[model samples]
Target chain A: MQAKRVTFPNKVLPYLLLAPQLAVTAVFFLWPAGEALLGALYAEDAFGLSRQFVGLENFAALARDPAYLEAVGVTFLFSGAVAGLSLALGLLLALAAEKAGRLAGLYRTLLIWPYAVAPAVAAILFWFMFDPNVGVAARALRGLGVTWNHFLDGRQALLLVVLAAAWKQVSYNLLFFYAGLRAIPRPLIEAAALDGAGPVRRFTAIVFPLLAPTTVFLVVVNVTYAFFDTFGIIHATTGGGPGRATTTLVYKVFKDGFEGLDLGSSSAQSVVLLAIVAALTVLQFRHIERKVQY
Target chain B: MARRDGMVERDGALTLAAHGVLILGVAVMVLPVYLAFVASTHPGADFLGGRIGVLPGPDGPANYAALVGLGAPPPGVPPIGPMLWNSFVMALGIAVGKIAISLLSAFAVSYFRFPFRVTAFWLIFITLMLPVEVRILPTYKVVADLALLNTPGGLILPLIASATATFLFRQVFMTIPDEMTEAARMDGAGPMRFFWHILLPLSRTNIAALFVILFIYGWNQYLWPLMVTTEASHATIVTSIQRLAATANQEAPVWHLVMGTAILALLPPVAVILAMQRLFVDGLTETEK
Candidate 1:
């Protein structure tokens, strides 16, 4: 909220400066959000003839809907797996890179560029490797006696999407973890080292504890990422499934709205997503404030 | 000296372990793309039920030539050229547009005190909570109502209002000493003049960093583009890859061309990130913070 001490003393100029952003936000963001809130309360009849005001009916239906419940479960599982896998790998790589000496820069460069790869593109890359027929990884798996057809197996489909999603995310998490690691004071690690603690012990005792804020921040980020951003990955690779196995909440919203034409239900789902995102954004900002204090 | 030598030996062993882990990590990171690249170089028939080789094949030039020049071998899949151009334009538009609006808004909020300034800031800040995914139907409706569907404006305009960039600029502006503004005023440098001459140069690094991040964001957009552009002409490379892959999935499975498209789709953003890595990192951390 801090502003410059000196005033510009030009009210008209300030409004002019703010106009474009405000106009865009109003049109693209605020209006649509308002419509979503209103639309969630009304049910449109078949053939788009008339709409009925259905108070909380859409939300009630979602709560009881088995498919929606399944999506909720899938989302949690997918997000948890992606976050856990990516965070652990990111931390491990960051720790190793810290000790890599001259090779650290090269390793960082190689590891981080994947951050720029689109989630959908990342899904494609992994899909090629994990395709049921003629896939190298699938062949290797089949050779090991594990059936790896994501097309038929629901769990395998989920796993494939998870891998694709997590693979793309690891680089982002690594960059943050590496920056967090670099910010940790060196002497603290050296002091722990002088006390005869090995690298593993030092990491568990000192380094890991200090990286807690970063880890927490990344957990929220990674979860939010897996929730919202991985829509592309799921859409491109599995198309939400071997049945509805890979159907996430966001994907379901898209399916129900665009494909199913369940406008009321989709709007209700949008409201739900909006609430979830608002909560996450608030949590993120609070953590950012805490991080600043640290 | 003997104890020091022993410590040195231990450190060397640890460093070796570190190198081992980093090498494995790098391999895991690069393997998929390498495999994809290798797959792209092979003849389409090679993937018709056999183990895929790890090495690049002789068909690299032919596959890429067909992909880049003739589009996918499939009947409906559009050429890579137009899709790539669409992606480039959309990405550049989003990045430049977001930065332009955000820079001005942040400047207004930080440098001037006017009525409804707080209201304006909050309005923009609220956008952080309402991602396009959340309000997909209605946002699509708005764009459609505006008749922006399948146009560059449809792709870029809806996405250009950025709260993160605005906040980042505000954060940057806060660090600028008040004296700079005071001195500018004394020299009669108007608000716009001061912004162009002083603030713009001072924030050049932030802008570049932001541009890198936003360009990637814009290029990688999937759902928005998928919803907005039903036309192949306006289809971005990222969204088009999905369509191509879906088509291949149903038919004879042209793995070579699909992989080729994937490589082309990812190449520009990856190159930008690698080329301006430091800026990207700084932009990422600063914006998130």
Candidate 2:
């Protein structure tokens, strides 16, 4: 909130400067959010002609709905897999690149381009590779006597989505992890090396511990990504199919609201998603504040 | 000398292992796209049965030409050419719009004191909590009411108020020494003039860096464009690929054309990130921090 010690002495100009951003935010963001909050409390008839005040009934119904509960579970599983897979791969790759010395830059460039691929595009890339009929990866799996149809198998579909989501995310995680690795003081590793520690030992005792903050931050970020951003991934690849196995909360909100036209339930889900994001944003900022202090 | 030689001998193996890991890592990252590119070169019939080829086929130019000119198997799907243009316009609009508004707001917040300034800042800050996906329906209704649906303005405006970019500019502005402001004031450089000359020039790198990140963010946007722009004329390449894939799922899979479309859809953003590698890295690490 701090301002310059010397000031620009124009009240009207400052307001004018802030107007466009404020106007867009008010109309597109605040108003819609306000409507979602209010709509969560009311229900409309199937004809969209009559409305009745429901007073927490919608939220209560979501709490009892088996499908909603299943979605919550699925979201946790999906995000956990995404975060864990990407973080581990990122760290491993970062560590290797650090030691690869001269080849590091080339590897970084080659590896990081996937960060530019959209989640939906990433899904299709993998979807093509895993196509049941003629995909190279699917063919390889079949050669190994493993059935690999993401179309009919719920677990296979979930795995496909997870791989797609994690593949796109690994580049992001690697950048952070590589940066974190570079930030570690080199002499600390040299001193440890002088004391006769192996590579794995040195990583566990020094490199991994120093990178903990970066890892923590990426966990929150990757989870939020898997939750919200992968809506495109799920939509494009599976459409939450194989009997809703790949449907996360965000996908369900889209399905119920836009597709099914269950405004009340969708709005209730929106409120829930909003609360989750707010909490995650707060956690991210707090972590950032702590990182700033360090 | 003997101990150093022994150390070198041990380190040599470790370094080789490191190179091994990095090669594998890069291969894992790049293979899917490579496979996709190879598939795009083959005729669609090649993927009808049997295993897909690992190498590029003879049909690359024809497949790409057809996609560029005529689009894919889905009868009504927009051509890759127009969708790419729409994607470009939407991405450029979002990036430029966000940067312009954010710079102005950050300049106001950082350089001036006004009533409700804190309130204005928080109002923008609250947007970080409500992504478009969370408030999909009501936001859709607002656009529909405005009759902005299926328009470029509809695609760009609703998404352009960026709290992250605003905060990034504010952070950049805070680092400017107060004496610079005082010097500009003493020279009678009015606020806007000083902003145009001094502040703007000084923040060029930051601006470029932010542009890289925001450009990618805008280009990669899927769910918003998918929901807002129903008409194929306004459809972005990203969403169009999804539509194409969906149709391919139902009918004979047009793997060649679909892969070609996917490659085209991803190329611009990937090219941006690679070309602006340094700025992209700085923008990402700094903004995230």
Candidate 3:
């Protein structure tokens, strides 16, 4: 955060150092974004070569389109559910593992293994786990004579998506939360107990407050992952399927860009999605990240 | 230690239930993979027959061998081994290139008093915000323009140079006392020498952390690779498996083969995490100064 007077050697050196990164970013990131914005404004035919500007047209289409509306609804539900559930589960597990004392590290290690698996592969794994015909759940449920159908029910599909998302996230959050919990002075909890405060009361007054900042940061990261990264999971598993029950915003983006090849409309969707995420991130930085404390 | 009114009983019950749930939670997390393992060892019939139990089957060796040896080609697609190899090579190439570039850039920024360091750092930082999806199409064109599509460069070029690694290594470097840097510089160590001998050794664990994460990121890659590569020959393990599943319209995918391929891709990153378990833990556990 401090300023150092930079020499031309320093000046050119950092640029030279940063040049490849900048080119990659520009080509891969900035260019696509700018093109997406432009694509949003202009209609493009197949082959992505032909184009014509149609101001606000794609946005209008997306606004009124049934698929887009449903995608928006599902996106909100998915992000909200995944974010909240993962936080609660992560915090609960972090508390459990942290309290295990000497075994905390090992427990944490094994517990978070799910997070280390690739997202697409994990989705595939869950697909097998949740498959109505072949899944462990299905087989075991039938073994107990309790029948379940995840494919038919919209809620079931969304629930599985949320669970899958949370499964990956809980481990990730536990990493941070366990560290946060470990940082809490044992003397404080000891003093709370010494003062006759019960576990629940002590957590409510002290431990929860101490854990707040970590929760806030995790919320931001979890929500971001929900928005962007976990789409592959949903794409692989539900495919915004069972009548588009699980399609999120990113799912729609993929549908538009790759599947539909409606670059203009998809680019518009991307712009809107990017705008929403950016604004939320700015909110996190301005309000939450600031309020978070050690 | 502080036993008042059977305090162990009170806290102990909660801990008991918590461990119960935690153990259950871990199982719930791991069981599907367990299924994958079991399924991988059995024949396609047992899997498609919806047999969940791991009744001893003779398919394990056959399936793993077929997957590893290109034993026989499926009807529409090629054998699995070459496809898996393509993915393996791509992951390794991307991982190695990314590490080299990131280390050089991270080193230059952390140790040198070069100009525009802040600007250069921030520029790279911007890429972290603009993830691959945002830049994906433009990058597709960047590759296309360079005639890199279907080539490893198309995959490797856009994939290299992470902003996260730069930030992570910078965090590690910042931990080293300035006196050490001064001492090394005073020994007339030039920039590259100092970076190799002094800074690198001190931050091996941090580098390992970056290696583990980056390798997993590269190895698990799906979307971009799917887009960049249009042919089956170029498919990564993910793509090959997806194609395997997609074509099994009348019957389920050969479960053993698919899971075997998944496990193959699963091995490298899991190994990185398991082998570097201590370093990964310590890297994450190290206190921020």
Candidate 4:
């Protein structure tokens, strides 16, 4: 909120500059969010003929709805898996790259471009790779005496979507993790080494502890990513699945609203999602606040 | 002498292990695209023949040709040419629109004192938490009511109203020394003039870095464009790639050409990342900071 020491006195010019952004926020972000909250309280007839105010009916129905519950469970499982796998792999790769000497830059380039690939496109690449009939990976799995068909098997479908989502995210995690590693002071590592500690001991005692802040930041980011960004992966590959097996909460919102034409329930779900995001944002900001204090 | 030799041996082994792991990581990341590219080059029957070949084949040119409009339109899917154009336009619009509005707003909030400025900043900050996915229903309704369906403006505008770029620019502007502004004012420069001449040039790298990020964000949009653009003409390459995969020729789902389109869909954004690696990395780390 701090302004320049020598500031501009023209109020009208400031308002003019702020107008476009304010207008867009009001119409697109603020208005839709308000509507979602308001619309969640009402129920409309399926035929678009009638409407009635049902204060918490939508919420109650969502509670009882088995599919909604399933979607919630799946979202937790998917996000936990994506965040855990991506973070671990990213940390490993970052450590390796740090020790890789001259080849580090090449590996970084090869590893990072996937972050730019669309999640939908990433899903397609994996979809083709694991397709039952023509997919080489599928054939390889079959050769090892395992059945592989996401199109028919729900668990397989969930695994496919998880892998694709995690694959797309690994690049992002690697960048942050590597940057975090680079920020660690070198003398500490050398001192630990001079104490006769091996590489693993050095990492556990020194590097890992130092990377804690970065790891925490990446955790919040990865969870938010797995929760929202994987909509593309689900939509492109599984379409929420052979039987809603891979349907995360965000996917369920789109399906229920757009595909099912159940607007009231969808809006209620939207409100629920908005609340979750607001909570996550608060968490991230709290971390930022702490960082600033330091 | 023995201790020195042992230390040298350990260093050599450690370096070798590091190289091994990094290479494996790179391979894991790249192998899927490599296989997809190989699949793109092979004949359709080769994929359907069970167990795809691992190397490039003779069909690359033909498959790409059919995709980019040298051949008949594949059944139920449009050619990739128009869709690519649409994606380009939408991405460009989003990058430019976001930069223009965000730069102005950041300038306003950081440089001028005004009523409700903190409230405005907080309002924009709130949008950071609510992605378009969470509020799809009502937002779609708003777009439909505005008759923006099947139009590029609808696809570009709502998504561009992001606080990420605005917050990024604000952070950049804060780090700029106030002496620059004071000097400009003493030189008889107006606020807009200073912004146009001094501030704009100074933030060129930030702008370029942001452009790379926003362009990718816009180009890779799936759900919003999927909801809004129903017409084939307005279809983006990312959305259209989904359509292509979902509606492949009934019997076998033409894996060859679908892979080709997939490659096309990924190329531009990947090229941007590779071309501007330094700026992209700086922008990414800076924004998150």
Candidate 5:
């Protein structure tokens, strides 16, 4: 734990090694964040040349802009639903697999397969299923009775986006939750069972509290996942479609930047998104302090 | 934590219920992949049938052949097969590069003392919170400015220096006994040699686990590739698959074809998971999975 001697060369070695990565992150990430924050506060011309220092003009513009306001509302609902669903499904699966014994490994592997399938592929796969005419799901549902088309209806489109995203996260959630579950001390569980506690009770009281930190960390992560990572899928799958009903925050950012060609608004939204994430992350560290005893 | 008397009094029903839920979960998780595989086998006609065709279809060869239709056969610029190669190449490059750099940096930070060591490590972790979305325009500007657009360098470079690997490697390296390092040093092993020979090999399973995870991560990436590359030909396999969904219309997206392609994408990761299932499970128990 203690260094024998601290030489000047030794003092400089590690910093020298980390310089490349540190430099890249700073220039590409840190510098950009600072620049983007500046850009967000300023208005820009049509060609993306900044025109003036507008104070909080962009944030005010977002507050009053109908599309921006709606996007924020939709963002919360979509992200919340996805995070909650994935958490529930993932926890259920993890818990079950934990009790699967010798077959637990098999279940865990199988469960995490979807995560490895990648969001892009997952989007395509689900797109096929929800394909209007001959998509397998549409066909099967129509064959039995009910007909569903995500492309035409706004409500269905929103539902489809949530389903597609939430389903894709199941495996990733399972991977972490399964890891967290597996790490739980067996003795505690055994002791609980010996005391005649049922699985549900034991889970609620013992396992859940222990998993609070992981769950909280995942909540922050999952919220970020829903917010940021789903942009591509939403772009590829729904295209914010049927209407703008499915346009979440990042999707709106992409739309403004790439599709609408309004780099300024997109930059503004991106800045806002970053602020939200930073705040949540700070809250996570604070929460982690209380929960992550190990 | 809770009173379990009711469950014990009821005998083994709780166990049965637990297994039941577990089995059901396993089924749901595996269902899509199975469907994709089966759809890959069947002719385009009955691909959507309710009847579960567990066996491979006779058209497996034709489907795969159709997929990889090389040269002038498919009558297009290219088919789906090449994208898989691109995905693999990109994923492998990113995985290897990220692993090597992170390990070296982590080794430096953990074993050797230097000014700002803690600060440097913290700076790396800052990226973990800063998802690619936050700095999309900046990174896009950086990549586009460098003219790295549509190249492997463009796709892979942005992810090469990851905080996750550094963070994980630091944690792993911190666990190594310093006594071993001192012993190696006493025997005339210099810092570089000691790190290369001893510490690296000692963390074999950790490295392997990370490599597999990273490989999957790269293979499945979408947004970054989509942003960097303009050419469909240059697209990674996942990109191509996503492009297919985008281009396809209201009709169920040629479910059979899309799912078949998905099956192709799933193969490498599934194979990795299957091959390294034991190591992964062990890694989970001993470290963070």
Candidate 6:
């Protein structure tokens, strides 16, 4: 809502500047979103020839559909696992890098480059490593007396996708966690040390609590990444699994609409996903504002 | 003296522990890539018959050359040379396009007032959340209906309307002293003149940083390109690599070339990140903030 006190008086230039962004948003984002909302209200014949106005029918059908429910459950499980795993691993890596002293920069660079790898590529790399026949890691695991076949087993397939997704995300979380660590005043840690507290004690009493804001922010981001961005991993590696085991909600939307040609249900799912993203964005914005005020 | 010695010993032990953990972390981070690179160097079908050799092979040059079409085309796989070009074009377009539009829009929102000004900002802001994956079907329908399918504009335009870039630029512009603008106006400089001369140069670092992030993002895109292109000629390295993997599974499983393509798919973005490491980190943290 704020603008420059000594602002330009040219009323026309601002509109011109806003036009391109507005046009793209309207055509690409807003219009499609509107169509999704509208399409969700109607069910079309599979042949795409006829349609009937069926208010809330798609929603009801989604509710009744066991596969949809499974997808939702799987999505939540996948996201929660990703968020938790990435955050914990990231925090650990960040803490280690902070303590790494002369090697910190090298460690940081090495650790963060994975953020640049494509999710699909990351999945492929992992798939190769875990390939039942030739995968060295899989062979290693088998040597330890465990069977590893993602193509045949649904849980293994889900786990594979989760790891692939979480692996790509760890770098993002690590960067944030490391930044948060750096932002913490060193004097607090020194003071704790002077009070005879150990490193773990200092972290628990002083550092971890101060990281609350960063943790919250990363939680939303990591969840969003897992929920939406990992579509590449699922699409490339598992294709929603040996039996839909790895099909997150976003994946289901693509599968249903594009592959299944069930436009109505897919649009309804998109609406649901949109609502979720909006809610997360609102939460993130509120937190950001609060952080700024702080 | 004894207490000092004890404190020194404890610090040394802690630092050593830290180094140990970091080394392990780095290994985990680098292991897959290292393995993939190793796998790419092996002769064809090596993954099928034996434990994948952990070390590099003699065929690295031939495999990579084959991947790029310098050698014979790997059987059952398309050359990644043009796919990489498509990816490069898309990435550059999205990055440049997003920055150009976002800079203008952020300038307008920050420096001027107009009807629907807040509404426009909010509208663009909403797009930060509505990524293409969520609205795939309808968005695809929009693209198809417009007959923009398989076109570079189709791949680039829809994605360039970014909230993060707009917000980043707006934040940077707000930090510029109001006096700068006032002084420019006092000199009878027009709005375009002020923006071109003052704001553009001042925000160079922000733009550069954002360019790095957006380029990586655009290059790594999979789902949208997969949906839009549908033509092999338009395929990005990322999507094509996946297709190669799928095909590999269905038939002979061209492990060597597929691994090579995977390596190629990741090379540009990783190179970009490493080359602009500081800016990438700054851009990421700042934009997220």
The residue-by-residue lDDT of candidate 4 on A1-294, one tens digit each, is 676666788979998999999898889888999988888999987776888899999999999999999999999999999999999999989988887766788899989999999999999999988988778898899989999999999999999988998999999999999999988877787777778888889889998998988888899999999999989899998999899899999999999899888878999999899889999888887887787876
For all candidates in order, the CA lDDT equals: 0.90, 0.90, 0.72, 0.88, 0.74, 0.90
Candidates, DockQ? 0.64, 0.64, 0.40, 0.59, 0.42, 0.62
Docking quality category of candidate 3 according to DockQ thresholds: acceptable
Candidate 3 — which residues are off by over 4 angstroms?
A: A3-11, A47-50, A142-152, A280-294, B1-10, B54-58, B70-78, B108-117, B180-188, B284-289
Worst 10 residues of 6 chain B by lDDT: B1-10
Q: In the order shown, what is each candidate's alpha-carbon RMSD?
A: 2.2, 2.2, 3.4, 2.4, 3.9, 2.2
Candidate scoring better on lDDT of 2 and 5:
2
Q: Model 3 chain B, poorest ten-residue lDDT window?
A: B1-10
Error of 3 at A274 (Å): 2.2
Put down candidate 2 lDDT per residue, B137-223, tens digits, no spaces: 999999999999999899999999989989999998989999999999999889999999999999999999999988899999999
TM-score of chain B of each: 0.94, 0.94, 0.85, 0.93, 0.84, 0.95
Candidate 5 Cα outliers beyond 4 Å, as residue runs: A1-12, A143-145, A175-199, A283-294, B1-10, B42-57, B70-72, B75-77, B250-255, B281-289
In every candidate, how many clashes are there? 0, 0, 4, 0, 8, 0
Superior candidate under TM-score, 4 versus 6? 6
Question: Is 2 or 5 the stronger prediction by TM-score?
Answer: 2
The residue-level lDDT of candidate 4 at B216 comes to 94
Clashing pairs in 4: none
**TM-score, every prediction:** 0.97, 0.97, 0.89, 0.97, 0.88, 0.97
Task: Please list all clashing residue pairs in model 6, or write none if there are none.
Answer: none
The sequence of per-residue lDDT tens digits that candidate 2 reaches over residues A175-273 is: 999999989886787778788887888899998999989988999999999999999999999999889899999999999999899999999999999
Q: In candidate 1, what are the lDDT values of residues B56-147, reduced to their tens digit?
A: 98888888888777534545556888999999999999999999999999999999998788888899999999999998999999999999
lDDT by residue (A212-237, candidate 1, tens digit) is 99998999999999999999999998
Worst 10 residues of 5 chain A by lDDT: A1-10
* Model 3 lDDT tens row, B1-289: 5322223224777778778767877887777677778778887767567775744466778777777765664344456666767777788877777777777677667655655768777777666566666555656777788888888877777878687677667666777777776676677765566677877899776777666666667877777787788877777777666665445423645656666666776666777777777666555444211
Window of ten residues with lowest summed lDDT in model 5 chain B: B1-10
Q: Which residue segments of model 6 deviate by more than 4 Å?
A: B1-10
Error of 5 at A168 (Å): 2.9
Candidate 2 CAPRI grade? medium
